[model samples]
Target: MISTSPRATSVAGEPDAMSAREVLDLARSQQAAEDAAAARKLEAAARWADLHPPQSRHHAASFTLDGIEHEEAIAGDGCPTVAEFCIAELGTVLGISTTAAKRLIGHALELRHRLPRLWAAVHAGCVPAWRARLVAEATIHATPALTPASVAWIDAQVTPFAAKVGPAQLDRLVAEAIARQHPAEPVDPDDPHPACPDGRHVTIDADQVGFGGTTSVAAQLDLADALDLDHALQTGAAELKALGSTESLGARRAMALGHLARRQLALDLASATRLAADTDLAGQPTSLPAARALEFHLHFSAGLAGGLEIDHLGRMDEGQRLMVLDLVKSWCGDSHTKITVKPVIDLNTELTAPGYQPTGRQREQIALRDRTCVFPWCSQPARRCDLDHTVPFDHHAACDDPAQPGATTTSNLGALCRRHHRLKTHGRWQVSQPASGVFRWTSPHGHTYRRDSTGTTRVDSDPDPPAPPNRSSRAA
Candidate 1:
């Protein structure tokens, strides 16, 4: 009898008992099979596109499911009929976003029409699907304008190295192919380096702010200006290290950048400090006189005062926290700063009242607790978000009665960016807050996800309990 157990077969050295090399080969074969299967699925999606051609630049379709009618409109000169249909149908079938589905369809069309050689390699499982998609994307811009002969030539050049090259190397190869095909096209200049630009031109943008009080900054500058900024940051970081600062070099550099900007702007630190000191805890202007009318509040946890480690909503590390404290000290100068302790309100408690709007303190507390937009995978910081009520406020209107209004409390409120807020209000996406700061997000496709301070966790995975809030070493 053929032994079913691997150990028993291995001891007898049965023909089916493979060596390590043979097992590895079998695994590789299985992986290739899976890749080929995925390629076939993509091809099938592409074929569906061909079969269902859009009748007009603008089209409307309606379907009924479970006695409910659903209608969708597709309008835009640039949107192909095949693309619209595939994105809608395939997105539902695959349990993915329409954006993702559109990308898959785009890759499929690019492979089938633009790069036949790459498609062949993908279909044969010689090239992984991701790499195939990358090649298709890289070549797409050039392929549109090029002649069939030129596209074929570029395809031949790139196909042989598709499986062998990494993303960066493949990008280089694609650039070379484009250059060879379009010899007259102007090449982009190299990115800003340490050398200063000849002219003064600087543009700064805050690309994104995440849950942890972390901000991503994007900048474009003249070469000389870039170099000068880099040098200043390095110098300041070095100076900080010399002055008994234990922060990492990266943390010091970030602090240096902030300091350099402040110095350049000639911030009136003393005037600002005086204004802040005169302001009440509620941020109301006090009767005390101030050097300047403008005041700034540095919102931070009291734990940092006692030198305790706290990750700012997963945004800052110990080094960053230390640098922030040091920056605050520099701002304070020689003045004696008073630290006040306040009673901590239980977030889980319902603090709602008659009105729909939450109090300023409630807003601040909610923003601090839920660091980002409560939408799953959304990293927009709470400060930049809209405070949305999970349940519609009852205003004795047609839709709701005043007797049972949704309370304007922390448990009923969650932060959502304007776009997502509209989505929740209008789109089929349903959201509920079973507890304070914890949100359950249900997508249009019926997938449910839980979101909180840390990030998103799918409900199907038996997610762990929400992590306890990291408390400050010193009681507030």
Candidate 2:
């Protein structure tokens, strides 16, 4: 007999091998299982949100749901309030980042409370959870905010087509709903982000720097500004070619953007001089603007083909390592870059601090030692994370007191992303540091994880005593 259980892996219980038709049937069953799993994820997220009511007294966002007012700790046009650190833990458990988990939870809550018809379709399995979540997210984030009647109207419009709707169709439906809600301000269904002054934006995703030392750049600017930048890039690319740079136009344009960032182009334009000739770009124009100090995080081991992580640009492969060295040499040697020397930090050296705040040198050593957030599977750069004392700092205790704990020192410090740090502070989790750069974390649910210089690992899951009540997280 073929097991109908969702967890069953076999297509035929008695078979040595499945037939072709049975194999195809198994694929269909897997699809159904995936849909069921997606539904469960949403349900679990919604339940988690329900378990964590907003605790901050500082929020101004209040909305009514089921005749009860909810003071949202996050965006509060009309969503249920949730505890600040709740999303991060859920995100970590789900192998996603906090922001992504928050969006998933928000979509789930919006579907459950505001868009009942679509929500019903999802639970009935007529609409996939992904499709319904998309509709929910669109309605929840619509500008001018939808009235309850408008939302109900949207629910009715989408529920029938929920299974097949795409973002383009969803955008049109939301725009139509917006128009119906406000007769005075008609919305163009075709125009998503209207060409309003407020809509012009330049956004950077610093977290997305790839190992190839490149980042994704996006911008929507005024027509004149856009044209001006294009012209500047063209000029810079032309100048690079003139100076014998053989890189592609795209690469040259990238370098041009860097020049703009360093005020190199600005200074030249201000002087009203053409690109100077000094054999290469090194000889170009005026002296390079004062540059930020560069810190190279390099590792050396045998023919071991060690690793290197550059600031801002991220990791560069050794085969393409000239990409980093050449880029640095171009900036420093060609661009007349300024070099400031600082003593190298010995990662083995442990330092002490007399106060709760770690010294700058101490922070650098810790950053170098950990290199990334001290959380299981978390890759957030340590330099960007908060220096947390495993023993929470107590302002009441004297630093020199023999009995006092929570001293700020290298041995006591590890880096954690803000959400994880807030989770530790307010999510009723516990952490202990047995050695410098070695930490053990205990989740509220009792799973223990160890983080060290090598990486993070889950050591065990022993039942922990019940955790304390949730507390409000301090604002980042």
Total clashing pairs for each candidate: 6, 0
Those runs of model 2 whose alpha carbons end farther than 4 Å from true positions after fitting are: 1-21, 54-78, 165-197, 263-288, 291-332, 375-380, 394-398, 453-456, 462-476
Q: How well is each residue in 121-156 modelled by candidate 1, as lDDT tens digits?
A: 898878888888887666655533666566677779
Off by over 4 Å in 1: 1-20, 30-117, 139-156, 180-220, 226-258, 264-345, 353-359, 394-401, 404-407, 441-445, 450-476
Give residue 384's error in model 2 in angstroms.
3.0
Best by TM-score, which number? 2
Query: Each candidate's lDDT (Cα)?
Result: 0.64, 0.69
Clash-forming residue pairs, model 2? none
Where is model 1 poorest over a 10-residue stretch in terms of lDDT?
Answer: 67-76
